[model samples]
Target: MSKTAELLKGAAEGFPDEVVTQATVRHLDLPGGAGRFALITLDNGFDHTKPTTFGPQSLTNLDAAIDQVAAEAEAGEIVGVGLTGKPFIFAVGADLKGVEVLKRREDALTIGIGGHEVFKRLSALPVPTFAYYNGAAMGGGVEVGLHCTYRTVSRSIAAFALPEVFLGLVPGWGGCTLLPNLIGADRAVTVIIENALNQNRMLSGPKVYELGIADAIFEAADFLEQSLVWTSAVLRGEIEVVRQDPDRGEAWDQAVARGRAIADEKVHGAAPAAYRALDIISQVRNGDLREGFAAEDQALADLIMGDELRSGLYAFNLVQRRAKRPVGAPDKSLARKVSKVGIVGAGLMASQLALLFVRRLEVPVVLTDIDQERVDKGVGWVHEQIDMQLLKGRINQDKANRLKAAVTGSLDKAEAFSDADFVIEAVFEEMGVKQQVFAELEAVVPEHAILATNTSSLSVTEMASKLKHPERVVGFHFFNPVAVLPLLEIVRAEQTDDASLATAFSVAKSLKKSAVLVKDAPAFVVNRILTRFMGAVLGAIDEGTPVEVADRALAPLGLPMSPVVLLDLVGPAVAHHVAGTLHKAFPDRFGTSENLGRVVEAGKRTLYVYDSGTPELDPEVAALFKVGDTVLTEEQVRARALEAIAEEIGLMLDEGVVAEAQDIDLCLITGAGWPFHLGGITPYLDREGISERVVGRRFLPVGTAGVPE
Candidate 1:
């Protein structure tokens, strides 16, 4: 047996039951006696929910299929070859689950080379090759199409991307090499690097066609038939496909440098995949396919064996598996149906809530405020947002009209919430104000109606304690920019009954959010840990740590946003309130900062502002801070902040605020924008030894976060 086959066989033995995307070959008769074409369909026998992925076994199968097509071409039995995917899905990329079984660098290198070997044959085939992308094609999947001679994409294709860089791995299987050669180096950098870093944004079918990635785009109703006809015509010399030659000039080098700078600013060079990807794109034009494949193999092997890749896999699994099945959530079957939703205090947050509810639930959402003017303004805001969606082509005019009509506003709470099955109050954070709102709501709301509060840090139990129907009230906390953030903390008060808790979770699901069942505690989950971490940073600043120094200290942690950056995004006033609440709850662990209050009072949106495109300390805000002689290094700042997080997470676990450490990790990942490459906060805490020092043990089992078993 060949050495590559031997390595693949060894790898395959370790992943026996991994889902293999089998390649099925069939003959397609060309129109008007043009010729016979061999069509290969890539399917995993799963629905659209399970996207096609290539593992060692799947790659081996595909290699055999390619061999068969090549043999048929040599024998003059087929004129051309075609490759496509199942309905509504081309392929997602490599099977990340298969990476979990690889324990050696040699195995990783072997698998990477094996994929390149199989895909390279597509381009080297004796006959023309075409890729019919019926739906989403991503990562390795996109690479597969690039290997084909001509490509046809369905207009219904929802996603297409090279997202390996986002998951701590570069496009290893011929992607780094072939992409730049097909598309210009500058455009390649945008697709493979910039888009991946920008939350994995994908290209639409029209965008792909516009970029010269696809030769033809057909409607979904006749996508397959039209693609087949187009392929036949191209094979018969009836149509021409032209591509612009890539430029390998100074502009290419400049584009690559720009991508590197973005990576540096975004991750502070903590993630190696981004750098490796830029390196590959920079050198793509310098080498042949063989050399490029070898480079990618080396990069993949090294990354596969790195702790960052393992951490990424852990995080991916946590999101793919654990987040979907919430740890402490009660039976979903007990959830009640919500036909109507009511929002109190129709301000920005409340208007956002009404928009989300009406659009997602397709139900009536009524907003009530203190007076007619406020209510009218809030309702008008919702309408304007819907109109913006219509203008952006996100929704049709009819859908926009329907959404606008579903959202109504009134000055009277009793009239607005009388028929609301689920009513949520986004009122003042004060206990008295929330309690009064709930009391009044309970008086008019139906007996079965559920009352929820959108408080970030207030005590849900205290607010419900004053109400006669306390059992019906639940804490439904949503982060700022409610439409974008995915987390919905469903806080269960002591008096909250199963029905109300289940309904709150149900409403969260209906709104397409990840719901974490949290106990009613001060600053429930994300805000609690965030408050503690920011408090430590603020304390260090008060003691003489420079603002930039403190902010840059956590750069190595690879958080999505920095401390001061987050503080700016989340208004300092809100942060101050949450800090005070946490200090009131756990005085020893959390300290209320007088500097925070002063900054809020001064109306400073951020401690730092942009000066000529560079971040500098705002002179007015800097004057408010009392810088001292004693200074801490970046290491000291990071340690102080992490220690605070560890201590607070320990207290939260001890108080049963969340069921386990993973929930806290999930909350931070989803709500606070923690970098997934760090495998959430707890694992990073464990890796830094702070979890052991402060919490006495690791948050997860030793090996769960890439530590040796």
Candidate 2:
């Protein structure tokens, strides 16, 4: 046995639930009578839902299959070797369940080296190797193809990516070395760094071919047969494949520099994975694949043994598992079918909701406003958005027509909502206005219909307080730009029944959103936490701190946007309103910013101007601030902000705002776009000792989001 195989002998000891992927080999005659071929199919025994992953046992299986093919090639029995996956899934990557059980650096190093040793044999074989990416391929799946001499991808494959950096690890299994050598450094940086940081953006099949990663692309229906024929043609000298020489000059240095800038902007140097991958890619300009492989192995081991990777893995599990099966949600069987929907208020928010509902539920939706002009504008906006989708090829013409026709607008509430099963109001944030809307909606809609409110900060319980059928009222709060953000805070009022809440969850699932169950508190979960955080920065600015210093205080935490940018995105008026609401509820912890109110009063939508391609504080907005004599440094600002957050989270936990800390983290991650490296703030607080110092305890136990004690 090889050193790698020996090292991995007992690596699967603790992974009991790992679904071991198997590699089976078969012999097939070349389509054009070129020669015999050795074809290997990767399967995990389950359906496509259970994608093939590389674990210790799975890697061992593949290693054995490679040995068989290598021997056949040496014996001149097979002219070429081919690798493919089962059904709709090519492979996702390593089994994270296996990675989670690794306890020592040696084990982590062993896994990385074992993968390199096994996959390297494909390129070393005497016969030419081919990879048939028949379906979704990611991480190690993509790396395996990079080891082959040629690759063919199916046009129908939905996702392809090297997402290791996003998960707090480098693409260590020959990816960082082989990909840049195959496709040059610039494209490698895009697939390895830029795309990974952009929420792990995926590449289409055509994109893979366009990037020079694949030699050819074929339709999914007969992808295997066509790939076999193409391979036969290549072997018979009937088809010639040529590749452009990789650029190893100044362009390589420029690409690596761009990758560093992206990593700094995205993670603010808080995570080390992106920099590590960049280093490996930069060293590839010397054309020593072995040196690059060694760098990858060391980097992988270091990251695997660090807290950031563990925290990232924890966050990944939370998003993949907990977000799907939300805690405290009512039974799915209790949900009522929403056949017809009604939306109150004909504004931007309501129009977005109309489009989302009509597209996801495929049900007739009506929007009502007090004036015909507003109603016509709202309906026209929805139609325009549908046309845009059609133009982008996201939806067929028939589907776009159906969606546009399904959404209608009317001036009469009764005509719009008399038979509707679900009616959500996107009216003013005032409690009285929302209560009046719900009261009117209850009188018009069916008795079994649900009355939902999209109020961001108003009390859901108070909104339903004036309704006769309070049991049918629930809070269905969606983040801004409804089509983009995935979070939907499903708030349960004091009088909300199980049926209403269950139906809300069902609708959120249909919208492909991550729903977190929150109580009807002052500002719910995300807005409340964010208000406290932003309030700290604003308070610093009020005390004479520079706007630039206050805004960049939390740079070390790697938040998606700076505080000032976030304030601009959330709108000064909206932030002022929410802050006022929170201050009223908890005056000591949540402060109302006078400067923010001034900005809103001045009708300023943003605090910054960007005519120079970079954000600069707007002079008019800056001149409006009323400051005190005392100023705070950036560290002081960041500390105060985090301390305030820890305190507010403790209070929220005491008040049962959500079930636990994980729910708060989930809310911030999906709703506010917080970085995963911090595990949504609580873990960062715990690791930094802020949670214990401010909250008198840690939010999570040791080893949950930190190093094991």
Q: Which candidate is the best by TM-score?
A: 2
Q: TM-score each candidate.
A: 0.97, 0.98
RMSD of each: 1.6, 1.3
* After superposition, candidate 2 runs with Cα above 4 Å error: 13-17
Per-residue CA lDDT of model 2 for 1-709, tens digit only, reads 8666776676666455678889999999998799899999999999778889999889999998998998889999999999999988898898887786577888888888888988899999999999999999999999998889999999998799998898899999988998888899999999999999998899999999999999999999999999999999999999899998898999999999999999999999989999999999999888899999999999988998887888888888888889999999999999999999999988999999999999889999999998999999999999999999999999999999889889899988988899999999998889887777887887789999999999898889888887788998989999997887789999999999999999999999998999999999998999999999999999999999999999989998888989999999999999999999988988888888888888999999999999899999999998998899878999999999999999999999999989999999988888888877878888888988998998899999888875455
Candidate 1: worst-modelled 10 consecutive residues by lDDT: 1-10
lDDT of each: 0.85, 0.91
The residue ranges of model 1 lying beyond 4 angstroms of the native Cα positions read 1-4, 707-709
**lDDT (Cα, 0-100) at 537 in candidate 2:** 94
Provide the global lDDT of candidate 1 against the true structure: 0.85
lDDT of 2: 0.91
Clashing residue pairs in candidate 1 are none
